[model samples]
Target: MMRVGIDIGGTKTQAVALADSGEIAASVTLPTMRGEDAVLATTTSSVVALAATAGRELGEFSSIGIGIPGHVDRVGGRVRNAVNLGVRSLELGPALRERFGIPVEIDNDVTAAAAGAAHLMSLSGTVAFLNLGTGLAAGIVVDGVAWRGQAGAAGEIGHLPVDPHGLECPCGQRGCLETIASGAGLRRAWPAGGAHPGRGLVRAMESGDADARRAFEGLVSGAAGCVRILALSIDPQTIVIGGGLSRLGEPLRQALGATLREWSGTSPFIADLKLPERVQFLPENTPAAAVGAALVSRT
Candidate 1:
């Protein structure tokens, strides 16, 4: 059987047709149009187009799963808010189902990504996901299921207090972890609270540029602190880091590794466990949430 999956990001929407075996038979991307029906419209059109390219009919697929960036009301299939999306109160699942006559499942994107990544890793125990793209969020898989807390606020690490009196987060918190540790966070600490020159700052860190190095260093303390805090609570066997910043490679890796030693306390419960998994960035064409969303449909 084949399923269609869509990952709707702030800037782009990606669709993939996957065999039940998890092979990508076809894929396509389109600029995301937020608000109104435009975003869902683009997704429906793209999925149909991709299915046709794969030599399959859209009706033949079992399901379409969407990983939304905002607060998804699972029961209602409505996206309530995602500040970056600038679109809210949209009925995605029903809208897509109504248009295409196929079952649609909408989920929080990070949660989907976490589920897919955990499965790909063959992670049997617990897996915690830290998503660091244009935004900061996390998702945890206990056993084989994502632990979505009450009101769906679990794994939202961006609003954690990296700075109590620092930048104001959209979540109405002061000094959110995202304000200092996300891509935008790095940009803010750059000379002008903006982006570094050239195409990608993480790549600059690879080139041994001084400013880029500083930006990463700035992230380590906060980022590592997060790991420690997570250790205290979740104690996940693996911590998977995704999104743009993980592309920084070893500079980012080494910094966090070193800080973990300092930040991880010596209490037996905290100290005696196996060394946590180092941060591993998922592949460019990764087991993303959309894939997980579709995978969920199969289950």
Candidate 2:
């Protein structure tokens, strides 16, 4: 039987059917609708589309797993505080299970991405996934299992206050890492870049836009801080950069590595950690969260 995995993002929803051999057999993407009802409907539609693409009935799927942004109650299969999706609270797992007559699992999107990255990259030991999307967050995996931590807030590094007088975060914190490294941060720093600031950042910088350069540098510096924090705290074997902003690709990787190397020049301990060599970027266009949700469902 195939396992179905869905990744519900702020802008899009993607679903995939994984064959028994663990390869994706079918996949579908749809625009995600906001609100509890609309989000649920979007998820259902994704599954339906995936089933049709796979040429199988829904019953043929053994289980369904979902990766969504929010405060997920993994045990209870509930989600709340998903501001991007406009979901104040939702009983997503129960609703989906009832509709499909199968087991459903819910997890944080970043966590699912970590799992998917680990699986897809064939990584072992400790792996950390740093998500640089609209927001900054991280997820850790040891061996094949994810470490969600107590209260499921383990990798919420975005809220960690870094500057006492920096811009205020929606989380009510000043100078949060998210305020420096995330897409939201970029928008604030380069308001002229419009809603999706990261998209045109390189072009703007190449055209000698000082504001864009400053914003991009800030993102790199903030991201380097996150890597330092991860290295000091979890000391993971590999730190994988994933998320929308990761599409910045080689330039992002080179900038991050250079920053880490510069920091290493200041401290022997950091130099010994080989932080620059440990960094990696997720392959573009990989549906890591969806694949990860399917992998998580198996557990």
Clash number for every model? 1, 0
Instruction: Please identify model 1 stretches exceeding 4 Å from their true place.
Output: 162-165, 191-199, 202-214, 262-278
| Model 2 clashes, total count | 0
Residues 107-153 of candidate 1 have per-residue lDDT tens digits of 88988888778777766677777887767788887876877888787
- Give the TM-score of each candidate: 0.86, 0.97
| lDDT of each residue in 1-299, candidate 2, tens digit only | 99999999999999999998889999999999999999999998999899999999988999999999988988788999999999999999999999999999999999999998998899999999999999999998899688999878888898999889889999887999999899999999999899888789999998999999999999999999999999999999999999988888778888998999998999999999999878889999999999999889878
- Candidate 2, residue 221: Cα displacement in angstroms equals 0.4
Worst 10 residues of 1 by lDDT: 190-199
- Give the candidate number with the greatest lDDT: 2
Which pairs clash (backbone N, Cα, C closer than 3 Å) in model 1? 113-289
Give candidate 1's TM-score: 0.86
Relative to the unseen true structure, what is the C-alpha lDDT of residue 230 in candidate 2, on a scale of 0 to 100?
A: 93
